[model samples]
Target: MVYLDNNATTRLDDAVLQAMLPFLKDEYGNASSTQHRMGRKANEAIQKARIQIAQSLSASDPSEIFFTSGATEAINWALKGVAERYTSLGNHIITSQTEHPAVLQTCAQLQKRGFEITYLPVGRDGLINLEDLKSSIAEKTILVCLMAANNETGVINPIADVANICQERNVLFLCDATQYIGKTDTVNLQNIPIDLLCVSAHKFHGPKGIGALYIRRKRQPIQLETMIAGGQQEKGFRGGTYSVHNIVGMGEAIAHSAETDWRSIANKRDYLEQELAEKLKHVAINGEQHDRLCNTSSITIKHVLSSELMSQIPDIAISSGSACATGTRDPSHVLLAMGLSPDDAKCTIRISLSKYTTDGEIEQTIEAIVAAVHKIRSNSPTWMLFEKGLLD
Candidate 1:
């Protein structure tokens, strides 16, 4: 299958697999157990992986990084950690309507338990208004959780500006950077006054179930209450035996992404869009093209139902929106919040490329999409009426 669903998850790198084989087979020791040579090796590997992840994010120290099951867990840790630790300061949190379900659902759960959450709306271009953010911050607001890049639309948020506002207000800033890393180099971490940042390794070609959270050393580290209580696994904040193989794989993936040249990937993504746009009409790009990730495109066809057409092109793997909502058939909340109608929302599909994607594969996917859109539009009664000028 032609895998254009890099946002959903990535195929594991062969190098990552090779790096992890020893841990899965012979070096199977719990990281917490430091008595034996095997245990020491496992513990050392975990520490090394932590440093690799830390370096990738330009983090000051490895101790400031917390490993988790994935970005979802990291997000939960950040939100609940700050809320519980600083409960006396305030109980209100702010985030955007375009965040992943991981961030949105966690905030929703917090609301059920008496916490106040303000969901900031995005513009038609999928950008959160900075002025709206300033107005939304109340004296009671304790934290703001905004994603660095949108998972569905691939739009990059103005995180540095948001961080500046948060800094001046003395409110904590948390950025979910899962979709941004690997696709683009992050803004200097030292310059941004964010308190916490989260990333998933699998999104960048690592094994599933491994991710990291970066806590700024300059800020009063969020004193989040632990979601899991056990032995002091992650410095008493999170408790569980670390996965040796997964952690190593995550480190390998981060190292690979950081070292590779990204300009080529950006060029390929541009080529895919130019070729597809040339071959098809009545298609709209979903987000601001200039501000989006070089490896992702969210496209909407005037009359195409996303799943129906996507099903016809079995070789090209893509999505209707976020990977978490791919099979739901629900209209994208991200698009709806951006003012797209339910019909337009259903017509949207996302194509996420990676460094591994090939030019030939992009051409094939474009050919298939061109044909599928034509097929769907030809059968659509709405298109018939609109073409005949019977309906505006």
Candidate 2:
């Protein structure tokens, strides 16, 4: 099977699995219980993983990184933590309409609790206007939540500009870097000044059920209330039995990513897009005019139902949209926010790549997609109507 849905998750790397095997078997120990040798070993592993993740993001120190279940939990921690601590100063938060359900749902919850949320709009290219963000910030605005890369379209946000604007306005900036991690190096704290950033290990070929949140604490230490109330783990921020094996896997994945030639993924992605455009007509790539992640392609084929095309190419693993939002009748909120009609949104399919993706795989997938589009459109009544000038 051709798996082109890396954005949903990646196959666990062999190196990462090997590193985690020892912890999963004989090295089982509670990281918090450092009295015994096994426990001490686990604690050391956790710290080493912390440093690995910290250095990967160019963070100032390892203490700023907090482990969580996944990026969803980290996102909740960041948004709700800021709301709990900074409500006295302000109750407004600014974010984009194209944000993930994690961010959008968390912000919606905040709104129900009396916070004002301004969801900035994106143009057809799926990018938030920096000026709108600047104008949205009020004295009551305490934080601005934006994503580094869109999960659906792969359109990159101007995070540096957003961070600069937030810095000038004295508002905290939280970036959801779930799709951005491992694909690029745009989330460096030293360069972007993002107050909070969240990443999932599984996005980068690590194990699932593990994620990290980087909270800025060096120069401008921001205060946030604890989200998980239980123990002294994560420096009293979260409480739970540490998943030592997963953490170790995450570190190994990060280390492995450094050696990968990601530029090759870009080449394959561009080749796939060019081949599709050449073989198929009435096809448009969303966010093509703007900078996007090198490994993602969101294409809309007019009069083509993504559901039908995907059904035709069952062996090829692609997605009609975000995995989290699929299986529902509603169109993608991200595409709608980017000015796509519901019909166009339904016509769009997301094809994401990874280091494991090959030139042959890309070619086969492109041929499959081109043929499937042709087959789907041949049976589509709407295509016939449009061809006969019976409809627009």
| Predicted model with the maximum lDDT | 2
Query: How does candidate 2 score on lDDT?
Result: 0.91
Model 2 segments beyond 4 Å from truth? 218-220
Off by over 4 Å in 1: none
Over 57-86, each residue of candidate 1 has an lDDT whose tens digit, in order, gives: 777788888899999999998998888888
**For model 1, what is the alpha-carbon lDDT of residue 100?**
94
What 10-residue stretch in candidate 2 is worst by lDDT? Answer: 183-192
Question: What lDDT does candidate 1 reach at residue 162?
Answer: 99
| lDDT (Cα, tens digit) per residue for candidate 2, span 221-283 | 788888788999998889989999999999889878777777898899999999899899888
Q: lDDT (CA) for every model shown?
A: 0.88, 0.91
